[model samples]
Target: MEKTFKFTPEEFRTSVKIIQYLRTAIGSSLENHDEQKVRKYIHQAIVAGHVHRDVFGLNPILTSLQTAQIAVDEIGLHRDGVIATLLYGSVANDDDHEEIDQLFGENVARIVMGLAKIQKLYEKNPVIESENFRNLLLSFAEDMRVILIMIADRVNIMRQIRDVEQEEARHEVSEEASYLYAPLAHKLGLYGLKSELEDLSLKYLEHDAYYMIKEDLNATKKSRDAYIQQFIAPIQEKLTEAGLKFHMKGRTKSIHSIWQKMKKQKCGFKGIYDLFAIRIIIDSPYNLEKQLCWQAYSIVTDMYQPNPKRLRDWLSVPKSNGYESLHITVLGPESKWVEVQIRTERMDDIAEHGLAAHWRYKGIKSGGQMDEWLANIRAALEAGDNMEVMDNFKMTLAPEEMFVFTPKGDLFKFPAGATVLDFAYRIHSKIGNTCVGGRVNGKVVPMRQELHSGDSVEILTQSNQTPKHAWLSIVTTAKARAKIRLALKETQVKDGLYAKELLERRFKNKKIEIEESIMGHLVKKMGFKEVSDFYKQVSDGKLDPNDIIDKYVEIRNYQENHAKEHEARSAEEFEYEGPVEDLSSQSDDVLTIDQNLKGIDYHLASCCHPIYGDKIFGFVTAGGGIKIHRTDCPNAPEMRRRFGYRIVRARWSGKGTSQYSTTLKVIGNDDIGIISNITSIISKEEKILMRSINIDSHDGLFSGNLVVQLEDTTRLQALIKKLKMVKGVKQVQRI
Candidate 1:
């Protein structure tokens, strides 16, 4: 029987009971505030057991009740915010132990579900970035409300983070908050929350650094406080004299942000902008706020020389998060860059509250769209390998970007350094796979060249041209990477698979065992995905057989002994055995690594990883014994299967270097540039050598024969499902 979640009688009662306490506190917290919706949201928490997952043992009654009261006293009730507070971390997945459906009204429960979905802005996927990005876009396209609720929930949670964990855990949470949540809050226009979150998160992400800065700030607090008072006096007096109802104040940059500036700009604290900014919040009709903003700008400019380029007009086109403010960086007293932001009280609320603040005014009905991108994020767990993780990373992280149009007027938004291949994939996968070249802003550029803001891009394609082996070096986006790799793998498998069919077709007449072992050994030597890869390469006029068998046999024995020796080593030794940047078992070979060869002395022969049940052979070659094909490799079959067959059988002699090679062929239905994926697997397997590969397709069919080099067949066969999963690829086999 499957295990299910259940709440103890007391826990269920306490989680929901906090609502009455919160409602009671709100009556005193605000001036004539409405509380029906706020109460409803609080009641939903018990129904949604958020703590049942990752954390436990907190006093739910005391914590929830106290937190709710604090929320009422401090933030008041923007019904949506209140609802989000109750449902924060409420999803049934991850650490969530309860279901909202059990205790809340459907409307409240649904919104809570949506809030839980938008949590991936923090998770990292170093590969498969495009899928993550695609999910983000689709989520936003589906609903903006999900993002709003999530942003609101995080801002509120950070407020109480101190109550949630041990010292180390608190710091970890804060660091995450600083890096991801704080920026998100800033983007959403939650100014008060954004500032506090940034400061608080810093206290956790880097404790020593955070405390050092705090101590320094404290040391100079007396003098700095006096300086702020004097600076704000003139601005206040001028605004008062002008009869404009205004508030002037000083501001300091976030600690982390200041540290980043110091590091990047290579400047001392004294060199950085030290003035507390003056904000003029006036009481005016919404319509009058614009005129007041201009008037303030003029007054400020009159007092100081305003930098022409350091001006922003968000009022005209509000940010996606609903933030709007007029900003100007002026040349102030002592020629300093003093930034001033002017806005009305209402605008201030929207900016500081972000989507949550918007929901307070707009109501859930207005903000009721579903966030599909968040749903896609929820689906991210399906990508089980490094390849998939990397793919997801490239897709989702361009939050502050614009998708402008090119001369022909096509549009796609890219992060600051997107390249031509990124542009091609943005247009369409087909365009990217067949892309031969590109034009950026009407000038021909190498496909790998970086794209700049305002540059229009055009792609070039070839009908017969498939994605090349060199394309991965140039493609910057995960979508492009995944597509190219998939296509290549499909092509390699097909070539070898077809070759396998042909060999079997020929061997049927000879009445000889087209031994799976022999065929595997042969294909492995040539670095084909399957036996078909060898046949197809031979038939296609791209491969030779000699030298493959000898190398295949030599490598097979080396690997067996290595595995045995490795298993005998202690676990501690196993943990620290290799490179630090990547930890895969075959970090050097399994997944392609970032390596600049000091000198190419070693060769991972493309041959059969001669296992115990197989007939093996060895061959001598120039440069090195690099080509390890099967003893019965078709091209080498006549030599081994006939005349020199006896010499091919070599037993386990002395234990040389535990190095070996095997090849694979991934053949399936034709796909555009199927060879890319095949080769990518070799690249990802970094240990595997890709000696040679070929591609061909016609009439809705695609075939790729790839030669993937590996230490042994164990690592080689890892590609079967991966290749089979590629779209349009019909089959995969060992070569």
Candidate 2:
């Protein structure tokens, strides 16, 4: 069905050459005999086996070799990652994995397995809108090397797809490169590779835009180079006179980044200044790196008028991603602003290569800033909530960030516009939940006060303060929101259980027998859809048990006298009807579940709100047929642990047609006509209907929840993005 590439004589010679080069490059770890064995194994596999070429018609063998070369040379992944890249295509099944294990080693086999699993995931042709795909890929790849190799492979593929005849295939590849791999590279600190991937993606996706910028840069190359040289000449002389051992390069901004800046600044190419930054990389001893960089900074500032407000000193405290540098903006030769960056050689290497160089210079598994970030990722994954993991992971990957400080001068970084509550949560969950206000720079500020760079903050807490429902709209950090959600849930559960016990005790004292069927009917007659909702109301003191007994008695008597008209579902009627072991992808008989299920009585759970195209499973209800829940539902862990047998496999069968009700929480400045603007956008959207909106305003800011009906998560995400772009709209989230 698909075209396959079989090994030829030329491939055998190439394999031998690759082995020889790797042996020398890898040094004593790969001896002559080991190299020969590797070459022999590759040659035999190629001669006897075949690999299906991609849509671009590139030979898998050549692709693998190129990826291995990039992994080893560019990414500094010289061990199992390189080997795994070369042999990844050979792994198709368990037997192949066993063979690899026996031939190479367990580590290589494991990497191969991980690579194959990710390949299978991609083969399923998942839509990009499903953000869970990234989390799934991460879950499959346990070792960081697997991810590094995959990134290398993606880079190699992007380099080759330039000439592919298949336009659609090439476009898809480019999108994946930009949307997935580029962000990964950026997060891992591979600035060079990240920029390359972004530029390539832009070239393919927006051919005209890419060439327009490229042509502009080409037309001005002479002048730009001349200006850079003129600017560097003076700095070079000053540094040389200071006896500093260093080299400098004028690094031009990537085309993709320039395009982004153009869009963000709402200006054309001619209007964009500071198109490049000058980097001064120093050679110094480990202990003297800070000294040298500061010296260089001083020398440069002395030569030019430095803008104090634009100064960024990262040497004292590096970025969480392990980037250390001193940044300053100064007036250069034409009275134009020029950005200058100063760092030592080691710091420069890490800044260019990211995690790979970090691990290489510092031994593997060392405790560093980058390692700390990785460890946080591991902890999030271990928590097993894909949505939460994605939220936290995306925050770490955010580009625009601001660093704030504690009263004790401890530095912390947060996404731009992070508020005082976000700072509190960043310190600890308990402090966040109890945070009443904050003292920012010796002035008392509200929790909603936005923080700025270098702001010294001290959180004010009250012992009796608990998280309010409205607090969800105040915090911006994912960790804070997740913790607040948890606290709210714990409070709900405790109240619901207490209310249920109180109601049961009242029924017993009233000498009234509580019948499941009659109670279910009575609850529905009272207009409550979920029994949990009824208990929540009772716990809030809005409903009294004495009044409930009176109503239940009235309904029970009426039901006893009249014949039943409809089937009633009990509170404990929920049941599970699927296998207990791994139900992630297996389905005995698929139920096309969305907002509604055909031929089956199913209700979407309110706890996590499973929308169309969401990863979902069915929980059989006692009298009710089923209830669909998102796989990442907040209550899923406890439900699965306590009611293992009630879980059933389910999936969506087709594109969703029916609209589902969802709520969004939005917070922003309380500007005039802001509400009207939001409503206008919603009304303009086709097939998107807003049912209701509630707004609360205090202290020049407003927070509101808008309930809307939409077809699926993709549309929901687009709507959220649009709302975020709305004037004065600061934050938006699906509740």
Candidate 3:
């Protein structure tokens, strides 16, 4: 008693078209599978009566089929990927997981399940906009094909977003595409999709800006085309005359890219001279691609006066995402700047479609540049925390990259603004953990030193030196930050365990039974969120176990006496309130002194230069005024022995706005730019005023003293740290 499935004429025609597309697009991938299976899946989708209708201008079943076609055609995903894409949404929504497993096997079912999880996450608004979107993408880490399908799905939506009627929904979708999906596409090296996503997003999110750029581009289209033709005519002739086979094409900048440039360069459309670029793609054998690219570059540069500063030789060292080309901005006929790009045919294909094209043309099962990139991303995700994951993802998405050299002349690429600590970690985690500083191009620099292109870095490590928690703030790379956090957590756990043992031993000595409830009560009373935090505080000597015992006894006594009234009283009523202090009228005091030192006219001692937050004491001067000195200051012991009567208690209380003069001493290897670097750091600080500077260089070493006026100890310490990071600087300390 089998039933026949009926299909409308239009549905039948659409199904036929999809079948034809799949047969042609995904040719041999379906050779082994029965043709009846595909028909059955399509029939089931049609019979279900669920349609995507509005957004994609097609039924959900057809949209899934089309997405699968795109995955096969564009990304070169395998048969299992295409089948999973085709059936995932419909089956998951219908809760037909077992049916999918029975029909397509467990592999396809697993992929569908993963995709269903992603859909579920998206439906539930987990966090804020960007973070939630990032999490949605990250959830597809298990199956790479799921990411491809999702990307294709978004691309399909973006393509049809113009027909979506809701303006607010369109704007939100556009923002998500621009901020999240586009970056994801770029990271995956799907350049064509990335560009389209960005362009479409700009059209919706910033219509006015988009239209303005479009109008400007249209207005200058005729002249710009003419100029491009005239400019490329000579270079094309030279490339052909050199016995090289090549093709030259002119490309106009996308509106989104133009808008970004306008904002970055702070210039209007008219000021942008190189709006169009000429790409000379050379045809070469597989073995001679680099050589042919360089040959084309030479020919193009020979025809024009290339701007030395504007030359970007990415062919020699390709970008981290596997982009390879030679770009140069040159002076043209009308004295205008013209951008020229030279690459081989292979490189041009990669430049257009990115990693997808690589996979398609190479005909390999992974194991290439893209694999390396994906491995790095996976490592970052596995090692990093939530925020670190986002940071690492953003770093991978960044367009700019800097190539720095090791001391042995090996080149390593890192994101711009990466510090020496990042470099050390990139080399090895051990090197980074033990690294105190580095020598950038033979000049000693702090671990926080930002590396630049062409700089040869030599790491300075010590056996005893370990990573500080401050290194987390110093590094820009996720690997270093994750390692530092992990190391710190391990240390904290060890200390916490030790503290727990110590507390348990003390409790035993006092014959007090320690229970989980008691420990929880103690932690809450001490204002700690967790027992481990309390233990850490105890291990750090900031908390006393005796205090906990006394509090426990006090609580027991109070509970025994007030058990009848405890339920009636509010939690606030039972809160511990110590004896109130007397609030008597006092004399008017304007000095920004510590709370303990009242009515004192105290200036910081010139010998010690104690600042805010320092453990300090007030010493009565011969002039009958007080001078503040740090408790650990070198002059403290002598002063305490000589003038014990003059000493008074002092501590930081209220904020201070008055500036104080301080002197700092810096030591480093000798370099002519040391003085300039020191002065630049000082000048950059708005709150710092330089009173004087003295620098002396001799025997490859330099010593400098800077007398500066600063507002407080915090700013002064920050300034000293900045000086330490400067090139050639070894140490910085207050005088």
Candidate 4:
């Protein structure tokens, strides 16, 4: 029996440290006490694999674990965020080890199952680019909380890969950072993770480029610090006035980002800007986020001229990841460019942890909040097909604010640009399919119309309306497109199978076996060179079997009347002797078969049998090899139609000078003196061509097979054709 692919439990001990670090780093709401359980469970997950304690538990992971612990000690994971963090990425690989699943439970197990679905999808059908797209979109649907935790997990993993010996490790870890991880981090609005991912990715992809940028950045360290201090000075004064508690810090751009810009823009150190940023972390509520932004803008612009275009008012419209911030770039002392980001405490938490911060939303029920997030994300995901994903995501997943009315003066929030169709689908797929259009402020409109922040949308659906192809054109979510395509493909297969069967039956009746087996042989024989080519011919009716055989033999072409000439009595059959030259004469056109040959049915007509150097035509006999005949033989006409394709225009050469047999047909009226006249013509002419002559008469009509000798078919036809126009001849042909 084959052994199961397994690794040791000690291998995952490091994962214990890594998961704990994540659990702690995420900080606070749901269940800090669960960390030990989560760690123990993951460690025991080694079914048939060895754990690399040092490999999985790296510095950043440990640091992240500490950060999560701080968050847990301070704010708490609320319920949803905790569940997501523990569950995501758990089911992707084989999980025969029982402890992890036993501890994580069904809720976490469900999320893992979702992740497993995506992994199995790609495993079954590998498409590198599509798989990435599919994984990203599907993760969005399973749970937003899960998405954030996985992003964090990836960030830590990148840091861990630094310890792997460089010789054999797959380069994709770093490559993934630059191409996929960083984009995901930025998309989630987790600037911290995004930056780390980029810096780490660049550190490996281009070591020299990263170091040079770092060195240059270090050179400006003091100035950058001083610049940040100056920008924060007025904020300090205001914070003191308002009695607000806050902390401030200065940070540098990630080496990856800096390196990317340097190479992409073809710039040196001087071209890069905003390498320094000021972060003002203020303790406040979500509503107070804008106040800090306004205050920070006032203080910064007062001291320095702000670039109007540099302003990003995300607080007015938080990102899809629940990120709220105010970003601006201004010209500081010495005209040096500087960037500043201001956000309240809750907003900061969400930025760092994304949906992970839902754990800290005061008074929010963890299960309800998580369920709501799952529902909304599922709404976004269940909207589009694979082809239109990026566009659909931009339209759905980008930060947009929706204003939905409640029954009693309340309003609900939705991602911006949500369509009536999205709303209907969000409500339920059945309603979405029935929804024909909707009203905004009591006016009818297309269902796909974008719902604005304050628009009171009332969806209208008709009872009889069915899904249309037009719906696919308007709907902008993966969820909608996938459902539509699945239905469409099912219907198409049903319809297509009918037509396929008809074609198959028609081919069957024609005795044409066009299946792979028969076509394979013909494909090889015809020298067409490709399987596709052969099938295409069979499908299109371009290939013919008889033609294939003729081509296979490389036979010469023949005249039309070749098959019928053998039935005529105008030629005689005889056996051949030594070299045909012994009996053959220039005027006697016929074929002589080798005497060593016996029981061959076809005979070269003595009147038209062609020997060496004679133009030929073939008379296909009822029994065998086509009898050689001259082109103009009288009886060659009917045979040409019956077997013209089978006829071969043959001519003998000195190489095959071995004896041959032939027959000649002589026809004349049965007058008393006709035979004597025919006999005398050849006998007196000193030609032994008239090997035999006979007379038969009924009502004075005449026909006879007169034996003669000459070359192959062509010369025979010429001689026989001339004999038909002879003064006393009724007709002449090869027998």
Q: lDDT winner among the candidates?
A: 2
TM-score of each: 0.44, 0.52, 0.51, 0.43
Can you write out model 3's per-residue Cα lDDT over 1-735, one digit (the tens) per residue? 113334468876876787787778656655366366755775676566542354334456656766776666656665566788877645626367787777776656766877886665444333324442453354334555567778887777777668667788788778878877788778677788888889999999988999999999999999998988888888877877889988889999888999999998999998777788889888887778778887877777777788999999887777766677899988888898888898888778878866566643442123454556554444433432233432333323223566566665455667779999999999998898899999986799999999864466889999987667788899998888998888788878888899989988988999987755456766798788877788878887988889877887676566445543433332222112222332112213234454543556667787877665567888888999888898988899998999998887777655645556678887876654556557777888986777766666666676777777766788987888788776457899888
The segments of candidate 2 whose C-alpha lies over 4 angstroms from its true place after superposition are 1-4, 7-19, 31-50, 129-132, 362-370, 373-735
Better of 2 and 4 by lDDT: 2
Please give the TM-score that candidate 2 achieves against the real structure.
Answer: 0.52
Best by TM-score: 2
lDDT of 1 at 570: 26
lDDT of 4 by residue, 321-439 (tens): 56668888878777787787887777777777653454446532223332345334333334311223212222233234444432222333456566777666656677777888887
Put down candidate 2 lDDT per residue, 1-735, tens digits, no spaces.
344346568766876687567667665444246545555666666555545666787777777887888777776655555677878765556677877777766667777887876675564455443334444444446555677788888898999888789999899989998988887787677888899999999999999989999999999999999999999998999999999999999998999999999999999998889899999999988878888888999899989999999999888877767778899999998899999999989899889877656644532232564567655544443432233443454223324566565775455777778999999999998999889999987899999999865467899999988888898898788988999999888878888899988988999998888876667877898899998888889998998788889998998777544422212322122222322333222223335645455556577888877778788988877885898899999888988998878987778765666677788999876653566668889989997878777777767677888878777899999999989877567899988
Better of 1 and 2 by lDDT: 2
Off by over 4 Å in 3: 1-15, 33-35, 45-58, 93-95, 126-136, 361-735
Q: Which residue pairs overlap in candidate 2's backbone?
A: 189-354, 573-622, 574-622, 575-620, 576-646
In candidate 3, what residue range of length 10 has the lowest lDDT sum? 570-579
Error of 1 at 175 (Å): 3.7
Q: What is the lDDT of residue 429 in candidate 3?
A: 80
Candidate 1 lDDT, 138-216, residue by residue in tens: 3332233344444444454555565665776666556556655556556545567667777777665666777776677
